[model samples]
Target: MKRSNRLVALTNYFLENPRLHKQLPYFVNRLETTKASVSEDMDIIDAVFRNEGLGYLQRTTGAGGGVKYIPEYLHEKSEAFIHEMCHQLADPVRILPGGYLYMSDLLGNPKTVREIGRVFASAFSQMEIDVVVTVATKGIPLAYSVASFLDVPVVIVRRDPKVTEGSSVSINYVSGSSRKIQTMVLPKRSLEEGANVCIIDDFMKAGGTITGMINLLEEFNAQVKAIGVLAEADDEEEERVVENYTSLIKISNVDLKAKSIEVHPGNFVEIGDRK
Candidate 1:
């Protein structure tokens, strides 16, 4: 094929596979091109990617060397997108009976979920995570989205035991909102010992559920690498059980009787990048 065609194909290949490294010879053989030609084409692609601030193409040398496409969501773009989300979430019409904001529509949108997942992946790209853990409910979509970008598996914590899953390890924890005892369980074989886990959730209020998940992880001898949430309730009177977590949006104020709500960008914007 022509050089221009080869360039387009090469760009598409890199776009399809991100955060993975391959040897230069691998691409050379796949494209039926010489090392010199591949290197030249890569130079052009690398320049375009860097200039666009989408991400960077990294090249290495020596025995185990190749180019890796590191997918990144630019901070400025992410901030702007989140600003729009905040506005939509702050609508008074979305206020629920129990001071909750309706977010089912946003969570159901594939395009929105994909973008949110990209942001989470970019934020935790530096960490070594073995799997993404989440409860068996609204958080599943966000968890799978992050798993796709990270190329890891997702382990879901269930409220009730399943016969198909075989034996499970169950625990009881007090709900922060209702202050009532609740049970949560996980399959015995769902996670490996000493694995690094990233916990994700749809919403957090007082962080009781997330804390229980942390306690469950302890039983398996696994380490908590990170915690992420779609929205976190910021109530001054109530202290959250899980302190260290990244949220995409913060619900600072909610008045159920008055039908009012307020939202702001989450901590992801401030502490997303790794040093």
Candidate 2:
């Protein structure tokens, strides 16, 4: 293969699977080129990535370190990829009784979760998103996956206060569906003033929990660049508060009697230009 094509292939490989970049030898073995040639190609790829404003290609120099690409590449390809996945998640059969949709399997599957995380991270790639925030315990994995892609930190919002979190600020917000009051708390110093935060969650029933997160972000004087949910329960009434947020899938309804479910992509993908 030509040197230029090799570089592109190498960079794409790293973008597709970041963990492999941690082992230099493994990444090197994948190529039929010399170590010196590989190093030079990586440098060229990194420059191309930066020049294009796609983000940065990070290289850690250590015994176990390898090369990884932090996607700065904003392209139509990325949007198409995300939209296709969103459509898959729109299956009605995935829904359960009581207006609930099953997403634990998707969350536990690293490939799916990583793709979902990348889609969100790419959306906020240009923003100064210092942290990825989510409420426990289902949202933790999504948060972590996004943080990894964004190369940022993940902060957890605990339902119950813990001594480890030190002093926390708590708030009570109305549930979007249940209409019952639910509480969400965050550590007082978890975020800095003027920090940009991207909130992620596994699912949305009433959007009450997300609103609570918004309120918490406000308390710290932080800015919410965007909100992402794995799936949203579709009820025109309950979805009012979440009109501004983004979701991978929308569950229109779950009819237990008929054993029918409905799902579709949210507005985020349709409107996201990511320019």
Candidate 3:
């Protein structure tokens, strides 16, 4: 293939397969090009990736060394997106009953979700997460998107047991926002022992659900490497349960009577370089 054609294929391959390692000879043979040519192509791609703040190519030269993409959504870009989301979320139209938000439209947008995933994936890129975990329903898409960029698998925790999944480990925990006891179930085979886990969720209110998920993960000896939420309720009246979490936006105040809402960037911006 021509150098230009080869470059396009190489870029697509790395983007589609993040963190996938292969020897230089593997690419040279696949592209029907010489080692020196492939090296030059990689250098060009690497420079562009870095300059564009997309990610960097991690290249190693030894016997087991190879190049892989480590997608890091630039901190500045992440901050800008967070601010834009905050502005949109502050709209009074987003206020729902009981001070909840109407964020389904945003969550349903593939582009938005992918962008959110990239931000979270970038924040947690340094962690060696084996799987992206989330509760069933809303969080599934976000989890899959993050896993896509991280080149990891996703494990979901469900509210009810599925007999088809065989024996499951279930735990009852109190909901952070509702303050009601709820049960969460996970299949025994869902996660391997001692797997590093990153939890993703759509929203957090007092972080009860996330805390519950964390407790449940302990049953399988899974390590919680990171926690990310799209939005978090910032109600001082309610005591926060989960710390060490990254949130994209904060709903500071939602007044039902006034039909107004307040939002801002999450804690991730304040706490620099959590990695």
TM-score, every prediction: 0.94, 0.73, 0.97
User: What RMSD does each model have against the real structure?
Assistant: 1.8, 6.7, 1.2
lDDT winner between candidates 2 and 3: 3
Whole-model Cα lDDT per candidate? Answer: 0.88, 0.76, 0.92
Q: What is candidate 2's lDDT per residue for 1-275, written digit by digit as tens?
A: 56877877887776666433465566467777677788888888778777865556678886776677777535455556556765666566666656676677777888877777877777667676889999999989889888887778898998889988889999988877677888888888787787889999988877788888999889988889988887777776543666567776767767777777666666556666542
79: Cα error in model 1, Å = 1.0
Q: Which regions of candidate 3 deviate over 4 angstroms?
A: 273-275
- Stretches of candidate 1 above 4 Å error? 272-275
Candidate 2 error regions (>4 Å): 1-40, 43-69, 72-93, 273-275
The true-versus-predicted C-alpha distance at residue 210 of model 2, in Å, is 1.0
Q: Taking the tens digit of each residue's C-alpha lDDT, what string does model 1 give over 40-111?
A: 999999889878767778899999988988777678777788889999999999988778889999999999
Q: Over the stretch 1-275, how does candidate 3's per-residue lDDT look in tens digits? A: 79999999999999989989888989989999998999999999999999999999999987887898899988999998888888877889888888999989889999999999999999999899999999999999999999999999999999999988989999999998787999999999989999999999999999999999999999999999999998899999999999999998888778899898889888888875564
Better of 1 and 2 by lDDT: 1
Residue pair clashes in candidate 1: none
- C-alpha positional error of residue 30 in candidate 1 after TM-score superposition, expressed in Å: 1.1
